[model samples]
Target: MQITDFSVDQNLKELTEHRTVVLPVACYVTTISENINGYIPLHWHDELQFIHVVKGTANFQINEEPVAIREGEGLFINSGCLHMAKDENSTGCVYICLNVSPNFVVSHELFTTFVSPYIQATNLQYLHLVPKDAWASNILESIRTIEQYIHQSQPFYEIEVSIELTSIWKNLVKNGIQLEFKERETLKNQRMKRMLNWIHQHYAEKILLEDIALAGQLSRSECCRYFKRYLNKSPLNYVTDYRIQKSQILLQQPQYSVTDVAYQVGFNSTSYFIEKFRKAMNMTPFEYKKYRN
Candidate 1:
């Protein structure tokens, strides 16, 4: 599906229009809606983003690193990072997103004068993910500076804001750790890879455990044992979960009826799809569509 038609992209555009992309200069506020679960469906951007969880809590999967951001905390997402955000059941979330275009930042005088001193020794390409311990104080301090600029907005407060933003990236790369995807369990090493690969390739197709076991080169019983140990769910359950995720996009789309969506996501029976969707999403297909609207 074209991502431009997707809700996340629309939300990002909305934020951009509102001047939340960056602080007080080229930045725009994409959104500040309440009662929203932070689970923004996946999207990408050329500009880098620093996502602050100002209120409530959020769980995110940043390319397989399962990290949680709490109130007053935030994440330093790299440029072009494929990330997903979901705030769990609780009060609504409000995030202050600071978007920075790397191209503009690097070419601008601000980067060459003040920022060049930091990246001089480093060869960092990806956006740095700032873990809590890695310059946590600096991260919090920068958020404060941004908040001050946002609230005060005095003459050229933007320049002060820019300095804080630069400090975040510079200190992050200087002190932040490069995080890779969490390693698969040692016990199910090979089998897990096969199953994950299969799921990724065929999430939209009807999947079965026997097929998964065969692909993983394990007997059904062994597959059941090792798969759950590593992935924390049964093979069939995992596939159902993936299908429900596909159903979410269809639900969000103005086109596609519930039945069409069900079948499109690989379910054969509408009743079964409704039941599964309700069980997974806590809302039936029809209700989900209405909610999206």
Candidate 2:
């Protein structure tokens, strides 16, 4: 399998790289320490995903809830769920990621009955798969087998992989039907995504708490509460963090001086920007730029 990095657009939807046009599926390995931020940034996609931790432990924030999957454990993320992952131990983490389009796995008739319901179920955001559980173990094993088949590329591997994927889907539907419904939580998650998207788009501008709340159609207090709940930070803090992240890219360009990067990323004062950047990255902008170069 390919080792790849993730890229996302303004809406935070991941631009996934597929293995083949016909299959609409991709399997790859990623190391948490290798990412730009030492973690996978928050993003979502329409495809369903399964992640198996191969080394160390992976800490994930899925739809604002924290879940940890250790070595030999796996996780199933529903379609379009906002999620991010990082290494829990700080040593590093190796994991296999499989992304598959739901439509490719089932026929139109079966999709309406067996697939759409689970994908559209707001309360069913993710499932943490552990090897100790019989059913969960079966699913994890199937995921491993699918990866092996794809990597080996033997004759009729596509057909064999399809059968394995279909079996996984059946098991997911059978088990996920029991989760309790919580439409309110789902709506909150959607609002949070809207606010996050606005922050990413407007990070280069002077953003206010009111602007963020307005983007999400929420009251200022509600906005603050949601940001704290979902991101564990105040809205303004999140904005500062985002601006610092953006500034790191501009720092790489020799044409842009430290002062220029600070202003470009919405900081009015270079000293203030340096202060924040150091706190977040443990290095000043100039130091980081020099190290990167």
Candidate 3:
């Protein structure tokens, strides 16, 4: 399939706009050096994802944990996990990513029996697949085969891809049945999602720490703890970063002046916006706009 970038909605749900037409699977190769930011931004989706590093090492954050996968290594991200990745070194990192929908991979009865438990397992956010482990190696090989099959697009290639995917899923279940189910992690994830959604929705308006905490039903301190635990940033810091992120998009358009873009993204002071933008991006908003053009 063709390579494509993805966007998320206010609630951080991936829009799934680039899946292949014939199947509920999307396969693409990503070269981190080619991206303006050299990383994929944090996002989540309901589809299961498999990623294989093909070149330099890739560093990833899955939920609250960090993982690094080197060349020839792979990772399995469970459904509903918040994740992001970046090139570990300045050198380019190339990887193949496949996102598969459970419904498309199995019948309803089979999905209930095989997929539901894993998807709902809060303690099992991700699995790092290495070549040394037998089961993980098998899954990795199956991923490679699926990537080949999709790239070739031979007759009945879809069926071949389906078989490989099933094999990977089987390996995952056979090896992952022992993971403990943690309801607390589930609740934590839910609260974090609520707070993040609130931030995204109100990012263009005046937002306060108490306002964000209220959206997640959290006190000010608990809200700070949760943000630090999951996102490694304070609530106000996250809001500033998000505002800067939004400003990047607006800066790409020629019609908006720097001050206009700054205010549009919730920064009340144009000078303050310029300072933060420079700190985060290492360039002024005007310079970034010029660079983009």
Candidate 4:
């Protein structure tokens, strides 16, 4: 019943279209949470990121990191890596999340459709995530530089962050790899496309206010406000409707029971699940299953 309104597809499409010169994230925002059990769910992006956990404990992993990050830490994941954040069910956390694109550094490196291996005769197109030094002062300074860069759209903003990021790379990414992001000149788009992509990723999980806040990283409330402004419903309802569509394929499977299938598609309560299904499909899961057969 947490349905509101937002168009996830439209939002991203707009972002993709803005091929800016100094490509930093819209802004630098921090999320501080006390619940150690809070999970960001699994996700990935084309942009490289720097995360500084200011306080408490956090269990974070970049692809192939081989171990979860312990408390009192930070991480710098390379571009286009599968990453997620969670708590150890022990302590709260305050972390800073920063994102930068390859174009933000090297604009000449246009994102190519074909992968290039062996740049210097070795099989390599991108780099891997790795570890760096943990000098508290350097981390603090680097974080500040990024914040400053975001505020002033001045000349050489990209250059400033690039230098600091290099320092951050040497200081934070633990046993990591480095790969540059691919850039394309003709990829500008409308906002709807981005929204579609965002919604596509987390539709199966238990999406929440923060979940859809990711629609554009607009604060959870703003995400709802903007979503209501455009798409006319909330992000939760957006996911539920999408889940119902995806469930149609599963409902036909004889292996599923209505209740079991509802949860599988992301409904926690069978009753609420049934209500949504009926609201969207004009029938409960039972009827849907019967019809499918």
Question: Relative to the true structure, how large is the alpha-carbon lDDT of every model?
Answer: 0.60, 0.84, 0.86, 0.53
Tens-digit per-residue lDDT, 124-190, candidate 1: 3233334456575686677657766767668888677767766776677557444334334322444
Indicate which candidate wins on TM-score: 3
Pick by TM-score: 3 or 4, better one: 3
Model 3: lDDT of residue 279:
97
lDDT of 4 at 229: 48
Compose the digit string of candidate 4's lDDT tens values, residues 1-293: 10011122312221232123435553344443322113443345556566666666566644323234433355655544444466656466566667665445333452231112112111122232222443544765687677677566678786776677656544433323353333321121112234546677766676776755665646777666654544456867767767876677678899988877888888888898889888876678788788769
Better of 2 and 4 by TM-score: 2
Tell me the deviation in Å of residue 50 in model 4. 1.0
The lowest-lDDT stretch of 10 consecutive residues in candidate 4 is: 1-10
Where model 2 places Cα greater than 4 Å from the true spot, the runs are 1-5, 179-182
Q: Could you tell me the TM-score of candidate 3? A: 0.95
**Better candidate by lDDT, 2 or 4:** 2
* Top model number, lDDT: 3
> Tell me, what's the RMSD of every candidate?
7.6, 1.9, 1.6, 15.2
lDDT of 3 at 159: 87
lDDT of 3 at 61: 89
